[model samples]
Structure formats: structure tokens, C-alpha cells
Target: MEATPTRHPRRWLILVVLCLSTLVLIIDNMVLTVAVPTIAEDLNASAQDLQWVLESYMLVFAGLLLTAGSLSDKFGRRKMMIIGLSLFGAASLVAMEATSPGMLIAGRALMGVGGALVMPSTLSILITVFDEAERPKAIAAWSAVAMVGLVGGPVLGGALLAQFWWGVVFLINVPIALLAITAAMVLMPESKGPWRKADPVGMVLSVIGMSALVWTINELPKGGLSHHSTQLSLVITVAALIMFGIWETRSKSPMVPLAMFRDKVFTGASFSLVLLTLANGGLMLVLTQYVQFVLGYTPTETGLAFTPLAIATLLFNTLGASLIAKTGTRVMAVLGLLVIASGFVVLANMTTESGWGVLAGAMLLMGAGSGLAMPAAMAAMMGAIPDEHAGVGSALNDTIQQAGAALGVAILGAVLSSTFTRHMPADAPQMARHSIGDALAVSAQTKDSGLLDAARSAFTDAMSATFLVGAASVVGAAVLAAFLMKGKNSGPVPAESAVDPATEAESDAMLTSL
Candidate 1:
């Protein structure tokens, strides 16, 4: 007779802690986006200084994720997470107290380090605590919490800004972090993979490669290959990543198992997610600007307007979780991507005369699709990894998704800027042709209704063009997912790699207890 698998009795409680850990990261970024104007004003920050404050965290976070994840598996996932929470909270305090842009940027970078440590551990720990039967539900709940944070962040930030200073946004994280840390220490069990030799060289190469890749992507919108620094960063990225791949394949004890990509399910899911996030990134980038600048909504109203997306996503996530087993991940993924493409097509038809109704309809469709697609795709990817490689596996997926989103932002930003400029009147001031913001500013200063109307119309046209590109990307993902899922085997992942029997038993017992 086969033995039954062990299930952690307190897995649901542990999941809440994990979700809390993830929520802080989402809320922080969203709130910071809303607070940018205020931050620039109070600090008297130059545009470059503000960009540093925004991008510095992402730069550090993306660069360190794989290393941190590997470290978490080598050490203890729960222990690393607690340390990350403490560091994140402390960094938030530092950022909140900073009087200079430089100080704030430094604090943000430190928070990125904490975020890198925290992110991978949460997913890895979830896989360990919950059996495969319950993993889908756990992931659904986790994804839903992220949607909540997405919807709530802007409204909360807007409210805070109305009553207090911009720094107050960072302060909100402290208490939440403290609660999560306390709960984590009391409730979560320590879990780690079997001991392995360190790969310092791999770590260094990964950090350099990922950071340089992000730098290249961020600069691509400005000058592409024309900028010498961008060209240099691109070269560094390609060289470092190629070397890292070659070294890992040859290493006696590799930091990451490149063989995961050999599984068609994992590879397919990875491609689907990259395309999904890429389009979604452009959606957020362009829609936020359209909502605020074109529709003349305040930040809080903009948050409220997005409720349709959040609500639809939350509902569909629950539905997808319940239905995924019956329909299979492939079907769910392809169907969801198709629905999202439909949403993009709807958005592509939007005109200046179109009201909030068109926007809400598009968001609902996209949200519903997201609710179905993301969990299914992620579940497929994570399902292919052995428990020992859980942390690094998730971190690898995170890195890919991050790069896709960044690339999408760069691509769509360039399209929007260039398209808007091309559509502007020949007689318009040069500054007015740069962006809708500049155009509106000029119109306000000169009292030109013609300029104001022209700017709004031009922005809507540019936004339409961007959404069409987004639509094409999503449609491509759907077709690619269908093709890739054909005739693929998905046998169970292999067991943990040579963990000591006694240690595994002790960890299992601790995890099962309340």
C-alpha cells in the first residue's frame, strides 16, 4: 500500500503570513507611484533624482532575487523572511525620515535588498507547507491579496497625501511589517533544502547581468542603440548572462538548475507569463496616464475606477482555482489569454469621447482573464520543480516576468511619446509636443482651449496605438501557449535532493504543528 502524504494543519494560517509579506511589496510600489508628484515637490528633486528614487529599488531588487532565493534554501526560508521583514521595516523608517533625495534613494535600495529576500521565500515556503492538492487554493488567495493591495494603494496614498506629508506613505509599512514579523516568528516553521556548495561566481555574474539588462531596458526608450551608455550596458548584459549560463552548465554544484526549461510545461508557462505581464505592464502604464490626464480624474478617483479590474480578478481567481483541475492548466491559460486580448481590443477602440464605461469594461475583461491565467500558469511552472529547488525556481520566474514588464514599459512609452508628438500641430510649441503633461501645462499657461483639446485628442490616439500593440502581444501569447502545450508529459517532479532523513522528518513535524 502507498503511504498518504502529510498536510500541514496550520497551512492556511501560514499562508496569511505569506500573503501579508507579499502585500507589503505591492502596496509600497503602488503608493510610491501615487506619491511621486508630492515627493518631487517637497524634496525639490530634479527629474533625474526622482527617476533614481523610483528605479533604484527595482534595480537592486531584480538583481539580488536569485541570490537571495538560493541563500534562503541554503539557510532557512522562515528565518530569511523574518530577517527581510525586519530590514524592510527599518528601511521604510529610514526612507520616511530622509530629508534629501539621495537619502531616500539609498533607503529604497536597502528596501530592495529586503524585498528580494522576502519575495522568493514566501512562494517557496508555501509549496513546502501545502500539498499539491491544496497548492492551487493557496496561490489563488495569495494572488487575490495582491489585487487588494493594487486597488487600495492609490486610494490610501491619495488620502494620506491630502492630510499629511508624502513620507507618511512609507510610514504605513512599518506597523504592517512588524505584525507580519511577529506572526511569522511565532507561527512559521523553518524550512531549507539540503546543504550544497556555494557558487559565489554564479551569484556575482547573475547580479551584474540582471542589473545591466534592466539598465539597458530602462534606457531603450530614450535612445536605443544610439546612446553609448545603453550600448555598453547591453553588451555587458549579453556577455555576463551568456557566461553565467555556460558556467552553470559546467559547475559541479550549480546554483540554478537550467534543466527545468527542458520540461515543456515549465517552458510554456514561462513564455505565457512573460507575455501576460508584458502587456499588463503597458496597460497599467498607459491607462493610469489616460485616467488622470485625459479623463481629468484625481488620484483617488483613479484608484476607485480600477475597482472593476480588481473585483473581476479576485472573483475569477477563485473561480479559476476551483475549475483549474477539471479544465487543465493549458486550457485555462489559453482561454484566459484570449479573453485578455479581447479586453485590449476593446481598449484599442477608445476615443476621447468615450467615458469611464469603456475603461471599466476593458478592465473587467482583463481582470477576469488575469484571474484565470496567472494562477494556472504559475501553478504549472512551480509544479515542475522539486521541493529543494522551489526558491530559486520561483525567483527565476520572477526575474523573467520583471524583465518583460520593464521592456513593455519602455516599448509603450516610446510609442506613446513619439505618436503624441507626431500628431501635435506643426505650430505647437516644441515643449508642448513632448508629452501630454507639457502640452496641458502650456495650454494652461497660454489659455489656449485649442491646445488643450488637441492634447487630449492626441493622447487618446496615442493610447489607442499602444493598446493595439498590447493586444497583439496577448493574442500571440495565446497562440504560443496552445502550440507549446501539445503532447507534453507532466509526470510528478522528483523528490528533494538528498536531505537528511532526520532533518526532513523534524521539519515536517514542526510544519504540521500549530
Candidate 2:
């Protein structure tokens, strides 16, 4: 008889280690945002250069996630986690010592590779370590920590920046990573699904396809859809992804199970997550700049201003999983999306003179909505996957989220840029028309309040327009979730319907060689 699975005795401790690992990666991404101006001045970088510095990391991270997930499933999750931590630590050191933009960007890219390896392993291991009955709470806790990391990043970076150079932000990751690696080694159990052979062709195709797609999105703000390079990238992205789908469907040992998309619960949950990330990512990006440029808040104050959002997220994250037990995934998801939409509507009306209380209320609503919806959506997706395929499943989840966030920033940023440009005086300097930061700098140098006023007004209009789009998107997601996600009000997801035993066994056998 097959042995019955048992929960690890040290699972909670292992979770702490995993949370630390996650915090470092999440913080690394956001911390850089607060330091962008300092870094730009230090490196003599252009706006395009700054964009690449951010996008390079996200692109590489998204591209490698699927491969990393599959590899983790074949190898031991703990082993892969260790390897990722090591790489991340090394990259942090490199970033800390970098004196040039190129060197810093290179370090960030390496960090992305490490992050791709680390991210899915954490979720996969959590699924493996916890029994089904306890999984939701574990996921909720994990989600809570992840949210904290997201909101805390700017605050942490601001604190560091107040007393040190921008490099200190990158440097902070090194010791934390080392500690996580050590703790993981000592506390986490080694676990893997059946071995699988590496799919080199699939990996190459996915990387190329996703990289091209993201590159196209990133470049759209600068050159619009008509640029030759953007058009070429779009074509390449489409062709490569199409080829990847065909190959995966036909391959004897597919990297991803294309059949999973047929499940409405899975598809709905996944798509909702994509939309959620898209809206929130764009909201955060614009708001960060708004507080800094238009409102003239210092980095530290700006970070503190996000406290309401963070608190709301924490409270809802803790409560969401339990609420899911009562109301089911569908209700929680739809409700959360509706709440988020309401918050976006509130933000759409914000102006330069809007009080902090008004901003905080909008943020709190968005945070609470996201906290409730995201965990439920993630739970639905995770429950739909078989136990053995946890790594790749989690990877798919992460990939969609990262891609969505990248698209959000790209598309919304393009909107803001174009609208601001059109609204600026025709004689405004090129640099002033490039971005709010540039416009503010120009205004400061020229000592022109009229120029500053124009920039602020343009930005406010752009932000309002973007928030309306976000609200509409969230409402659409709510409608989709109401219809597409299948679940009855109550307890754990029905297992027989959730996992196909035959397919799971087949997948295990196919992955036996990696």
C-alpha cells in the first residue's frame, strides 16, 4: 500500500524561512523604485536606461519561472531553494559594489534568475508540507507575509536611504538571504515529486516568447505600437507562443499541461488574478509618483502614507481564508473585486488638493479587496492542480502575475506619458515632457511655478483616466468570477473533481528523468 502523507513537524518554522526568502525578493523589486532618482543621478542614466534597469529583472524573472518550477519538482524543492538563495545573495553583493548602470542592471538580471528559482519552490513546498485540511490557512499566512513585503519595501528602502547610499538597499538583501539559506537548510524538509526530464526546447521557446512580449510592452511607452522594433517583437511573441502551445500539446512529455485551461474554476481564477495584478500594479506605480512629485512628499513620508493600505491588507488576509470556508471562492472573489473597483472609483476623483484622509480611505479599500480576492483566487488555482505538479503549477501562477504586472506598468505608464505630453505646453522642454520627475526637475531649475502647475495638472488628469480604466477592469473581473468560477458555499474543495489521478500519474512518469 502507498504510504499516507504526514505533515512535517517543523512546517511552521520552514514557513518562516520561506517568508523571509520571499520578503527579500519582493523588497528588492520595490526598493529600487524609491531609489530610482538617486540611482539615475548617480549613474548619469536616461529615463530609458532606468526603465531597462527595472524591466530587465522582471522579464528574466518571468521567462525562467516555468523552467525553474519544473526543475524544482524534478529535483528537491529545498535543494533548489538553497541554490536560488545563494545566487540571490551573490547578485546582491554584485549590485552593492556596482558603480555603473550597466553593472547594476546586470546584477538585477542575475537576481531575477535567482528569484524565478526561489518563488515557485516556496508555494510548492507549502502545498507538499501541509495536508489538504490545513492548506488554506497556510496559504493565507503566506499571502499575508507576501503582502507585508510588498507594502513594507518602500518603507524599508526609505529608512536605508535616509542614512546611506542607494547601494545599501541592494546590500541589505545579502545577509537576509544568507540567513534564509541557512535556516532553510536546517529547518525545511527535502521534498520532490517524481523526477522529470528537462524540456530544453520548451524552456527556450517560453523564454523567447515571454521576453519578446514583455519587451514589446516595455517599449510601447517610448515608441508606441507603430515602432518597427515593437512590431517585430509582437510578431515574434505571437509566433513563438503559438509554436510553444502546439509543441506542448504534441510533445510526449509536455512542460505544461495545456488541458488545465479547460477547467472553468482554474481558468477563471487565473484570469482574475492576472487582472487583479494588472490593476494594482498600475495603481501603485502611479500613486507612488503622485505622492512624490505632485504632493511633494519625501520618500519616508510616502512610505508611511501607505500604512493604511498595509494595515487593511493584513487584516483581510488573515480573515479571507476563513471567510472562503463560509462563502466559497466565487463569492469571495467577486466581492473582493467589487470592493477593489469601488476603491478605484474613489481614486479616480483624486486631485492635487485631496486630503491624506481621502487618499488613505481609497487605499484601504483597495488593499482590503486585494487581500480578500487574491488569496481566494490563489487557493482556487492551487486546489485545482494535482499534488505532484505543485511546482510548475505555482510557477504558472507566478508567471501570469509577473506578466500582468509588467503589462500594467507598461500600458498605464504609456497612457500617463502620452496624456501628460499632450497636455504640456508645446514649447515645454523635451526632458520636461518625458516624465513627472523630469518635469519637476525642469520646473525647479527654471524656477517656473506655471510649468510645475501644468505638469501637476497633466499628471492628475492622466492618473484619473488610468484609475477609471482600472476600476472598469476590476468590475469586469468581478463579472467573470461571478459566472465562471464553480464552487458551492462551504468546506474544502472536492478532491475527486479537483485532481485527475490518471493524469497526475502520467505527469509524474513523464517528469522522471530531470
TM-score of each: 0.94, 0.91
Identify the runs in model 1 with alpha carbons over 4 angstroms from their true place.
486-514
For residue 262, model 1's alpha carbon misses the true position, in angstroms, by 0.7
In candidate 1, position 67 carries an lDDT of: 92
| Residue 177 Cα positional deviation in candidate 2, in Å, after optimal superposition | 1.2
Candidate 1, residues 334-407, lDDT tens digits: the string is 77888899999999899888899989999999999989888777777887888898889878878888988998
lDDT of 2 by residue, 1-514 (tens): 6765666899888888888888899888879888999999998988878977888888898888988988888888889989998999999899888888899889989998999899999999988887665666778788878878788888898888889999998898999999999999888888887766677888889999988888887787777877898899999999999999999898877778778888888888888888878888698889989998988888888888888888898888778877765556666778788889999999989998887998999989988997788878888788787777888898999988888887888877877777878888888889998888899999999999988998998899889998888888888887677667764311244343332445334323432321
TM-score attained by model 1? 0.94
In order, what lDDT does every prediction score? 0.86, 0.83
Candidate 2 residue 71 C-alpha distance from true site, Å? 0.6
lDDT (0-100) at residue 291 of candidate 2?
90
User: In model 1, where is the ten-residue run with the lowest total lDDT?
Assistant: 489-498
User: Looking at candidate 2, what is the lDDT of residue 121?
Assistant: 96
Each candidate structure's count of clashing pairs: 0, 6
- Tell me the spans in candidate 2 whose CA falls farther than 4 Å from its real position: 1-5, 43-49, 422-435, 488-514
Most accurate candidate by TM-score: 1
TM-score of 2: 0.91
